[model samples]
Every structure is written in C-alpha cells, then in structure tokens.
Target: MVVSSVEKPIAKQPHASRLYRELAPAYEAVWPILARKRIRAAIGNLELDAGHRLLEVGVGTGMSLDSYPQSIDITGVDLSTEMLAQAQRLVEEERWSNVRLLPMNAEELLFDDSSFDVVTSFHVISVVSDPRRMMREVVRVCKPGGKILIVNHFRSNNSWIARMVDSAGAVTRRLGWRTDLNLHEITADFPLRVERCYKTSPTSLFTILTATKLDA
Candidate 1:
C-alpha cells in the first residue's frame, strides 16, 4: 500500500493576514524606496557599532536593511505575511544572510527578555491599533541601555498642519492606517529618555525620535 502526505496550512497572526494581503503590493512598491533614503540617513547619525543584535518591528519591505551594518544580526517582524513574503524575496534577491523575518505583532513579541541591543521602527506607530502596548513591548525586549529608534510622521501641533492631518485621517484609515498621534502623548507612557528628535519639513507631519531604554 502507498501512503499519501498531508500538508499543514501555515497559520497567521490575527487580523494581519487580510490587511497584508490587500496592502502588501502597494506597500512593497513605493515604501522600500521612499523609506530607504530617510532611514539610511537616520541610522547613519545613530553611530551604532557592528555585531549588534537588532529588532525591527513593522519592517515593511525590509527598507531599513541597507542602514544596518552587514556584521550585525537583524530580525524583522511584521503582521502581514504578504509583506513578509516580499521581504523574504528582497532578502534573498539581495543575498542577505544576516537577517531573519518573522510574522509577529509589535504589541506582543515571542522573543525572550532583553534579546536585542536595539529596537527600531520606521513609520509604524502611526498605523498600529495600540501604540502604547507596542511601545511597551519594544522596551521590554530591549537590553538594558539599548536604544529605540523611531522615524515617523505624526499629527501636527501647528493649526494648519493639524487640519491637513485631520483631513487625511479618514482616507488613511480606509487604507488601514491611523493619523499620527502626538509624540508627547506616546512618549509619556514609557520611562525612556529622549536623546534627540528632528523635525522634517512639511511640518506637523513627520518626526524622528531616538530614545534610550532606561535600566531597571
């Protein structure tokens, strides 16, 4: 008698597979290029040394891959399988052996405590449903004295820019994104101390923050 084999379906994290399947194509197309340049500049200014273990949440299309040192060990997580599929392709096409991709939520991570030397996110907070939980998780997994690097566009405090951001919220939401929250509000939830922040042009829309996770 001959026996047949059965293949198990790959399980996905909740609420993410749909969003990723729908949005992954567009996100993969433009984001990799658009975010690449900005992130490179931001990481360059960070002065990170080689051989660091880094965690990148919402690492769509692996744009930040170029910013990290080749000697570093990097792991990237995203909720979208479609996005991860694209990321995998990018990594393979580029022959990057130091990077690993996993499907995960920023609000919850499966990694052990203090597993990473740096936790970074690029333009992610504005879109996640629970930024506070995500921030806390990021801090939790980072080693003592590790840095959290965030480059994001946020709601403007300026009246005119605030109006524009508010107006854009509806459209952005339909496409599965949240309007940028005030940085001050989110930062208050963490014990982190801001090392530096830079305001990019077209104000009230974009900001870059670098914070160091405090030791317990």
Candidate 2:
C-alpha cells in the first residue's frame, strides 16, 4: 500500500531552512534541556538492531547519532548545510563509520523505493514545508514491514489552545515551524498502519509516533 505523490498546493515555508542555518551553531546549546533526553527516548523507541539501514530526515546536528548502535547503517539528511556540517563533524569526532550525512529535502527524497529498513525523523514534521509530502516520501523509501517514527509537537486538541496557536502562526514562522500542525491530518492519507502514539517530555508537549509500512 504505497502512497504516491500528487500535485497539490503546499503552503511555502520559506524561512525554515534559513532559520536552521542561523540556529545551527547554537541549536544544541539552546534546546539541550528540552531535546536531549527526548531524542534518546525517540531513538530507543525505534528498537533498531544490527545491520539495519536507517534514514533520518531532518538530522539536525546529528544529536541522536550517538544513541544508535554502532552496528546499524545510518544516513541522515538535512536542508541546512550548516547543520549538516555540524553533523559531519560529529560523525568524524565519534568515528562513526556506519553513518553518512547529506543535505537533502525530506519532501523529495533521492532514494529508490523500499531502500531502507527504518526511516525516522525528530522534531521535523512541523518544520517541513509539506509534512504530508515528506511523510509519503518516508513511506515510499522504507521497505515493506519497515518501521517509521516521528517525534514532534502537534496542534493541541483543546480548542482554545489550538486557536491561540493558529493565531500565532506569523510569529512562529520566524522560528522555522508551525505551532498548530494537526497530526491526524498529516498522517491520515498515508498507507502505513499506526502502531502507537504517545506523549513524551516533562510537559508532554511533544509526541512520539510509530507506524509500520504495510507489506505489498
């Protein structure tokens, strides 16, 4: 049940890549408290084993690299050259021979269909210009029965909070992501089967979602 890309109008997120470029150097320092543990938790939830080929979209600074087992093969992609530079440095510093970093768009992946055993992204869905398109690409490249994982903050179900977030869109755009993205809307049309969805972090502001690609 592979989903095919369709022509549709996707609202442009013009500042997203530049925002990450500007924040690349200070990103880890600024969000360490909120990000570190949650990232480890997301990677842990993947339950990757040796020889697995993992593709990480939006691999900013490669902060989650160290958490993965050394035996797994990893290819991480990001739109920001600066962020990929930081990730490259980390890969070298850690001498992670199993890892590779590239600058690419998640919405338009370059890989062949069913190329990887696992595909994951962290805090990235909200930042991409077209979350649904990016997700379709994720599913398209993942092998049948492969796992897909995503961790990010979604639009609150509470009406008041959701309205407030939606109203603050202009302000949040400068920060490189939307504050009111609907998780269900993003995943609704995809062919994958949802495995689980749960909130994480101290404030429970973010969610860890896991799904498996249906076997063809």
Among residues 3 or more apart in sequence or in different chains, the pairs in candidate 1 whose N, CA or C atoms overlap within 3 Å are 156-204
- How do the residues 103-207 of candidate 1 rate in per-residue lDDT, one tens digit apiece? 777777777778888989988886777888788888888888998999887666678877878888898787667776888867885768899888544433557
Residue 153 lDDT, candidate 1, scale 0-100: 76
Any runs in candidate 2 off by more than 4 Å, and if so which? Answer: 1-14
**Which 10-residue window of candidate 2 scores lowest in summed lDDT?**
1-10
Q: Which ranges of candidate 1 are over 4 A from the true structure?
A: 1-17, 202-204
lDDT (0 to 1) per candidate: 0.78, 0.84
User: Given candidate 1, what's the lDDT at residue 9?
Assistant: 31
Candidate 1, poorest ten consecutive residues by summed lDDT: 1-10
